[model samples]
Target chain A: MANSNLPRRIIKETQRLLSEPAPGISASPSEENMRYFNVMILGPAQSPYEGGVFKLELFLPEEYPMAAPKVRFLTKIYHPNIDKLGRICLDILKDKWSPALQIRTVLLSVLPYCLLSPDYLIFSIQALLSAPNPDDPLSDNVAKHWKANEAEAVETAKEWTRLYASGA
Target chain B: MARKGKEDYYSDAGGDDDYEDYYSKGEDDVCQSDTDDENSGSDDGGGGGVSDGDDQQAMETTDDIEPKDREKEYDFETEDDVRRCQDEVTAKTSELLSVPPGFAAAFLRHCRWDAERLENEWFSDERRVRGAVGLAAAGRDGDVPTALNDRPLICAICFGGYAPGEMRSAGCAHYYCHECWRGYIHAAVGDGSRCLLLRCPDPRCTAPLVRELVDEAAADEDRARYATFVVRSYVEEGTSKYVRWCPGPGCTLAVRSRPGSRLYEVPCACKHVFCFRCGEEAHRPASCDTAGAWVVKNRSDGETSEWVLTNTKHCPECRRAIEKNQGCNHMTCSAPCGHQFCWLCLGSWKEHSGGNYHCNRYAADKSEFTGEKTRREQAKASPERYLHFYERWATHGQSMTKARQDLDALEGGGLDALADTFGVPPTELEFVTEAYAQIIEARRVLRWTYAYVYYQDPERHGRLEFYVFLQAMAEGAMEQLHKCAEGEKDALKVDVGDYGAVFPAGYAAGKLAEFRERLSHLSRVTRSHFTKLVEGFESGMAEIVL
Candidate 1:
């Protein structure tokens, strides 16, 4: 049985987020699902991912206390920590946790950060594809592409965004 | 294995015997000389260790200040009897329940000598006052020396003989074996609290246990005995006085008194006679023919605990040898207290074998006493009066806990969004005090935080307090957490490079979901709060960026 506070805490947190002046972004659980939420982030003006809103999916686990909720990207974007499948590797969302850390702080750090890092994408992703960084790399083809032809890598990334992201 | 916080209670009471006697007799020693001082100002009641230094010299100081007068000068009291040990273990243990009332209360009064007192008078030394710890080195005057011939290895607190391996040395140069000292201190602060009262084992010396010395000396003795000793400044709680048997061999007697009572009675195998308040063997409670064998039973279910029984040598733990009172076979011990209980209903408290302090912390919520109900009205009967008692008892500390939990709605996936988190179920109806306690707490905490917030941003601070006020009106204290969310996100950014302190329990539950779900649709970060919100973005995303 749901304790009466279940709906209450949820309503309080949502109203708390919406009425607050949180510039260019607002996120909340869809009206139907209490455990899942939809997020909206405005692109940074100085970044390549600018002028676009991005989205992601989050799943809270039963052992939420000892473990972090599993978060994944629903948007298709080119980034180092994010793969084509939208799998993200964040620490605060995983093992290195303290009892003090909470949800809103996680949003304040993770989403905007993934959009800010274009250098890590080139270095880590290039290393992942063309020729592995050996010490660090997620895929080999992009890494091989980076080491062999730098121009080709940028062109390929632009081409991928144009096609997959409707940039064309 | 014991009732909530009860194990230490009785075990501590065992150590309380002689200590309480010491303080009750303390006034007599001082009054013998300064008969006029008997009614001295209450402030002089327990003058911490005698640092009345030069004053003694002016009166001529050659250690003429007897060790027995130490409590009078310092007020490092012993309980008047076992029943009122002190705040440390009074409520949990039946030990105090067994002690006579008067002696225990006297000892308890002097136990909490505050830091202010410890500084201004206790340790000053300029006042010609000296404490009991200073005496082991400074020989006693003409009074009979308390040192027993060989000392028989008995614990000064419990009056029971100490096993060779179980003795604790205190700052006052006195000692109690492992069982008594460890049990006493443990009851004061659960276990390993480093609690310190450091007084003489003779029961009345008021001094620190020179704890540093015991640490230095622990090398040659049994590790367990060393564990028994401790020294700290916090007052002991829990070991309130209860009448108890003197641990003295062949003495086999009990006292009926508490800490502050002026009169006390002691029971002996033949005819018990003793004054616990005055520490004199004057009058006894039991008559000649009505004593001898003491059979103490441990009954998990009973009214008014029984720690000592006369005329029959029964073990305190097993009423098997005892003709029990309305007892049944539902016994148990859960953790360290090893208290017995009815296996099925889990109710009742009982006495354990010699010196064991096992007992229960609850009473059965359902009362079966029905002698007056013979003329029962079957058509319409009233509901039981104690029905709500157990519920209230069970949720005792729930409101103050502030424990926020995350329950995953993953099995069937009907949860639409993570905006809502669950609050604990209130144990009572809407009108109960617990529901309001949360509101009161929220308002109080908001008040304290208001000054700190105002210093950070005066305008934002005023607005924030008003926001919290709205939350209080809407819900209660815990719901007040919702009010801090926006401000918290703002605060998290300013200190992101050092954002370690701002984390709360549900940080990831909402933040991560919002960040990830929203980031999927975003290709830019042009928002203002975006800078503030991103304080944790890099580190937080680092976990999922793999």
Candidate 2:
């Protein structure tokens, strides 16, 4: 509440997300830093990512709405958009950032897109930077490995989720 | 009769056409015939046209032979009436039927002047006459036998020649190459000719093989050929739809006509054929519109709605919903009742029942229920309680009110207080924006009237009304909570549960826990869901917007 610009925006978004935080995801701010946060997403049960727990890290900059905040995966997982650094590849987190969009809307769009379907370019920075056409893929490795060998990828991700995110 | 050789089949054409791989099928093969010009087809495999058929047929032909007599028909003469006229070529053979009257030209045509077979044709004018007649019998321009059963017809599958005596007949009036026929019969199960069908060798012919002809007096080769025709017919569906038949080596069942051609729907028959097109064991409705063209036009837009739910009091076909809608018309509902009826005959089926009120009986008392309320308000006041009255409705086939009123009852509660009381996890609810606070506040005010009324009156029937009103508001509040979770997939400190595509069991459990956790900490449930919003997770939302 101290910072007029940042606090009001945070308060507003915080309220919206609490009211409805998507279908399978759970999220909260860290105790130490109100601006730094953690999230819990139930793996889209119908998708390959189902039954797994995923954690993410979000940090609001001094200038947030004007500039996109940085959100990254704290846990290593296989996805077309999120890279090794935990940085999310969503367009809203980049040059496409708009003032009209809020935290709740941005996060709402993320879950069903990431966990459900294979289309991550909408929320992925890497997918956009490399493979522009959804038809062709930038990380053809993931795309091919996922589309062709989906069962293997699903098993491996589940193993990783159980070993890491969903466990102690 | 020409010997059934690859070289001989192509000898009629005499040119090294690219289709050298596709040996022309002659009428001599029982199941097939020479491909008309329309079928100059090549396949990916070298025997593309009949790779599977050719290999299978070759094995079958080899298996049937007795080592004692290897009869190869070489120097046989064809019938004189069907002999060729010069210069006319049939598309089936792709060659001139007879020699031109000129000697020099006819000599050039056979390539007789070439090196190997003869040094020269000069002295033997008699050799020339012999060559002309030889070329004519090749069915180049001659009207060789086209009757499927009488002549050894070409097997449509293997493209091999069947010797005249080797051919047998079937119901569909088609023939099969003997080698192919033997394999076909061997592949099928049963002593009954039902497995065997005598069919035409012409490609794309929809005709089925006559079962009786093959069943009664078929040779071993003919029986096998008939079996193959029957099985392939089952797979083809429309003409010979296989509902479900045990493809065992010797099952003589023809249960294809059985209703519900499904895996478990297979009613045990002494005989059976599973129609592949419809899961029904027997005949499937051939067409959708043709079966009964009942279009479901949306009352509002006059546009056709896709949800064509047919109404039925009892399962029509099996009288069981268990097998309902299995096939096109004759819906074999999977219910134990075994209701088998046409979907069209059942009529239009709207959700016949409502919350504690069946539309049928509800329609009668509709005016009594809507005395003071508008339709939308009535819809909103669902989950209403009529504790004792509900017993009567239950007997009438109506559902009852549920325990959980709205999503808020499950999700948002005294969350902030409980979070402080239990010293538990901080607010995990994601945010959409506080801009909707006014709208939520307005709805909360709208919702409080029922709660206020419930508070003021303990015995009044109005108490149930207010409880239902609160449930509606709670539902809207829950909708907001789900909406925020959707946008935060890429945010920091993400949980594993946010990605449920279809609400799964695990997701439901996690969500319930999360909802309970949110309600425990908060004091007042807000229609805006602002109370459920925690101080944390906002940065992830902010990051996502970036």
Candidate 3:
């Protein structure tokens, strides 16, 4: 019922996301709202958050494709770029967003590598966990901690990932 | 002889109001004759026999000397003028760069409209310039596949399959559906003026979505908005060094200061005058820095510090500020630091027993109280000094508004009524208009003098006194003119209930003529005094001793 009256583009993206789910990521549309998706991203390997599963929520606004999708973390994690309330500081989610970018491209994409799409370099939630940009941080305190003492900050992040992001 | 010659020339022209033609005849003749006849003409004083030629001579002489009187020269340009300027630059850049006007405009914007720099960069390295400007360096030759393909291709955006010709791109192979392109442009335009630099929706593509693409794909409203942003960018960022939009509310005019001119005061066509440097109301006689500081000082809670010094006493133990609303001499500091002290001497209240209060006596600790006493006295004196000038500054500003309102009332309907009462044409009441104009100008100069005096160096021993004297002279002349124009004119007004019943035609005409003469003379005097004040301030009061 929620899928009724959804745009052809959104329906197509949702179908592709379900049939060929990206590696280490799962997303499913909420039953009450076709635009809302419950998302889960596995922390990238070799990162401090390696064995954790981070939950996120994504919603395509009415002005989707024209506007960027709203994505926020639901699980608590100690990352410089993600604030306590789970806002992100990614450029693609804000000013640098292009209409060409799909929900899969933002969450996790398995598009075949091609020369035409040279800018597509695995812009995924796991990639964000792997490379937490501390410079343009959403959390000032976390960024300060990350800048002042990175190794200690990484240990705190690892502890938080184990305590909060570990899916029991 | 030259005055006679000029008068004959004006008379021969047959239009007494041909001041523009008279002025343009010869600057030397006007200046020379102005000096010779201005004093005698102005000094003739309210004589019933004063001719129209003499009045014209007096006014024209004032105009002739005005260029030397003020420093800055500027021209007000309307929004259409700005667009014309933009088009001219776009055309010039297009011809020079050997590109279309749209591309030229984009290139000019990329280089901040510095055509010389764009030309230099384009000549030296075209590819780098193209890349920097977001143009496809691969050239627009065959990159755009506008020809219909055999098979329909899927658009990268919207995930919708479209016919080959239905997809569009900005001279790049990264094609998206027209609907998506329109949405992207709409969103960018809605964001604000940054849409002027909108690039292709493909992230990796360096192709700029030029005006052609916007015109072809953007919605009607977005296209208009994009055009506005383009023109605004040309004025705001392109020629920002010399041109500035007038800060007047809802005014689309701009003022372009002459290049290398250091003048700040700019009067827009909307009659809203402002400082070009600071964008504040035109404040002459005060430097932009001083005017800015004075405005902040006026707005901030500066009096709070002074009030604290006078009304509240700090707790002796914890230094917490405590105010005594209503109580006896004994004061107790609030909780957490409940220090008790005498209000008068700030001595420990423990020493003063009940019904034996003698805290009124000065404490025996002169060294302890000296600094506090001096600081308190200084704080008390500071606001008084500030208020002295502030009250006058604010009074003149209010007077200016009231004078403007009076002028408006006179022009709106009062002039015709007065003309009917005096049995003269409404055009004959121009002296009243001139008087109000003089009052407004004098009030503006007088108001800014207070601001200048507020920041005047106190160590400049006699300079402040001299400047105040000049300000008083200007203000004194202005008040006389204001009274003659406002109060005296009101006295001449025949009551509407008893219109023409009390005063005879001859008596009313005589009164009107006398009032006009006095108002004109006062206007001239006030103008001269303010002119001197401006010159004195402009020269840093060099004639007076420090």
Candidate 4:
């Protein structure tokens, strides 16, 4: 397998992710590049995008755990924090990133279920959907809409999810 | 005290050699004698005794006197001085707060180097201050477990197994491998001065990665950079309002203005003079606001708008700018608008046809020309007025630059050439150096005076006129002095090969002496004129204004 020369950390994390995937989350390494992963995260239960399956492309740079992993949405989803270019505005991906944070903690694991201590905060995709911080927004128009009338904004997000993230 | 005429001054001082000797004694003597004339009633007596036995006594007295105001206003500080200042502050804070120097430095930085504020907050609520500044709690200072366990442990960062000796942790015992710690510190250091505020790699840990940790883990160059940032933060963020980094490019020196004095102009050791208040080049006659506004106006495209207003006429219909290249009165704007109008009246061209070309004559109504036409005229006049002051300001700036270049040339090799031609040593030509320096100083004053005058309320009639008169007088004297220093020096140069026949024994000496006298006399006149100009401006020409 192309994963032969991968770091032990990456190999262990991939094995764990495949064997015991987080609820509503699935991630597997791509065939060609072990550092590249194909991830599918189902929206949280009560969110507007609950029935939607959001695909994301996550790449572990050479800096790996020292730097945050580069993740972006592959499927089009309407969210205040996600811009039209699929770039997410999350703290861990930027100046707040720490060397100790792992891909699972960044993408999927819930606070209680995370193997890392409960205090090790996880800004998982589901958590981000569950609480979209419109204050620190990447998409200005969506944030304005969300601020002006959140219910209508949520309806528009649901419509977008139905159209673009139907898991066809 | 009687003012000495140019001729009387030179003649009274005696021959060229004697006058040169008088000047070479130094400028301090001239200032001393001037001040003595004002204070002591021994004017003529002291003046006469300047070349005699009293000269030594005068020199000795001048040496004891210092310009007290200048000495108190500002001081130039080197890099070491700034570092010493930082160390003193850090030590005092550390002693008072009962904390390590690293923590003290961090607290000072958090409080913007305000030691008093840090003390206030620390004493008010130590725990809150500690939390805010990312310092560990008091009792947990030495509670970091020794990383000497026998069993291997996994580094959460790299997920690698290492013996306890290879691992490191901050007060919060979240261990990371040495390699991972080094990499993290290196990355943070690369980010910039903010690296000084870096925390531990544990996402949840609030333990600040202090300077000691950085010094131990950072690479050689990164460590040096981090050290630089630490030192700079003290000066740049310190609570001391008096000290400021010299704004000169690549200059590492800092200037400390006096605590209560309002003196804003400071000259650095590098010879770059700047206004301490605004960080701009020293502009004396103009206030900082006027100079700043002038500089901004010069840099912005306001002049381009003015030029467009003067050079091009806007199409009456579309308002697109159109320039008339042809001589015909009928004008056609190009492309889409294609509006046709008379160039003079800016009326429809059809009205001018059938020999009804009366647009040249004044309209009897006069109301048609009042509003827009008058406004355009006023707008055109405004740019012309700005250009008048701007051109003179720019011209003086260019003259100053040229004079500086001349001074540099004289210092470099021109002095030697003049000496060779004049049959004297290079040291004898110091008058030329002094002349160029005076010209440069005068040029700078004159340049900023234009900016000052441009901002003066034009409604104040006699004050501005008197200022202009003073400025003109100074400019005239400066021109004469500049001519003597630049053109006349070249006139003294003769071919070296024709040295023997062209001049006899006393001829070169006589010519050199004459040139020296003219140059020195002009220099003094120019200096006095500019001094008067500055004093007049400083006094706000209030005598005339009243």
Stretches off by above 4 angstroms in model 4 are A1-8, A108-124, B1-68, B140-151, B283-399, B423-428, B441-481, B494-546
RMSD (Cα, Å) of model 3: 17.0
Cα-based TM-score, every candidate: 0.22, 0.22, 0.72, 0.68
TM-score of chain A of each: 0.65, 0.74, 0.89, 0.89
Tens digit of lDDT per residue, candidate 3, span A55-86?
88999998888899998889898876677878
- In the range A4-102, model 2's lDDT, one tens digit per residue, is 444555765665567877665566776667677687666665555556667777777755543456776677666544445554445456434543345
Candidate 2, residue B499: CA error in Å? 97
The parts of candidate 3 lying over 4 Å away from their true place are: A1-3, A108-124, B1-72, B138-151, B258-263, B290-396, B446-473, B495-506, B535-546
- lDDT tens string, model 4, B391-486? 999999898878877777777798897787766899798778877767877887899999888766677888889889999999999999999888
Share of native interface contacts present in candidate 2: 0.00
lDDT of 1 at B223: 28
Report the CA-based lDDT of candidate 1 relative to the real structure. 0.32
Off by over 4 Å in 2: A1-5, A119-140, B1-546
Model 1: per-residue Cα lDDT over B54-125, one tens digit each = 223322222344433422321122222222222333222214323222112222223332222223443455
**Interface DockQ of candidate 4:** 0.17
CAPRI band of model 3? incorrect
Worst 10 residues of 1 chain B by lDDT: B288-297
Q: What is candidate 4's CAPRI-style docking category based on DockQ?
A: incorrect
lDDT of 2 by residue, B1-546 (tens): 001231222233222341222123221122121232112221111111111222233234323432111111101111111112111212111233232222222233233222112224423453454344232222343322222466656544344567775655332345654444444444332323234221233322423333333444446665565545434333222112222333424643322221211111121222122222233322111111111111111111212222222222234322222223211222333311223333333422232111111223334433321221222332243333322222322321111012112222223453343333323443433121121222223232222222222222235566445444544555466444433322321231133334443444465346436544544223123422322221111111111000
Tell me each candidate's i-RMS in Å: 28.9, 30.9, 24.5, 25.5
TM-score, structure 2 vs. true: 0.22
